[model samples]
Target: MKTYPVKGSVKLADGKPLASGVVVFAAPEMGMEFSSPLGDDGSFVLRSSYGDGAPEGTYKVRIERDPSKADSQARGGRKSAAPAPYPAKYGDESSSGLTAAVKPADNALDPFVLVK
Candidate 1:
């Protein structure tokens, strides 16, 4: 399927960058999904298993911490697991209420600002 570039950033309601996590874009009706790791600045560029970008469609977006990173951090040296930076709701598209529309051209989405 043809795809288009999708990029965006995530920030807290207070204007602080999330710093780490993964951003997902899922189009359930199309059975297509894309994801990207959050940069230190909380920016992302979506890519699917097939390749970079996603096909044109509307998608429900979600943000979650990378499980591998979380696991490693837990076993590494930290005495206690640090609290999650974002609310749990942001991890579930059904409840997160985040969405994006990808067009045939380049798509630079608005920042997803989450509230605590």
Candidate 2:
């Protein structure tokens, strides 16, 4: 088993932080998926089932924000599921158009900017 440190941030096209989202790295060739929660700054670290890092391979990345969480936070904790700020295309691996190739070293991915 091999792994590498992977990390990056997500931003809107206008340069605002995505705030809260889940970062997914899907490696269908290896039959594995790694994920991590985005911080308030939209930064995330990829962690696989093996933990702490991801298997060395090519991966399609997707970042999805939980609308309910965003709504509640926006309304100061009153629970509500709002519409997603990003387009639907950004929520799926096949549509996001984001990819990364992880190596056996600290892989600092480039920042992803989601646009309509």
The clash count for each model shown is 0, 0
Best of the candidates, lDDT:
1
Candidate 2 has a TM-score of 0.87
Query: Tens digits of per-residue lDDT for model 1 on 1-116?
Result: 78899999999888988778899998888776799999889899988776678888889999988766776767557644677777899998989999999899999999999997
Tens digits of per-residue lDDT for model 2 on 1-116? 77889999888888898888898998887778898888889888987668677987888988877665676676665675666668888889999999888888998888988988
Alpha-carbon RMSD of each model: 2.0, 2.0
- Report how far residue 8 has shifted in candidate 2, in Å: 0.6
The runs of at least 3 residues in candidate 2 whose Cα sits more than 4 Å from the true structure, single-residue gaps closed, are: 74-78
- TM-score for each candidate, following the candidate numbering: 0.88, 0.87
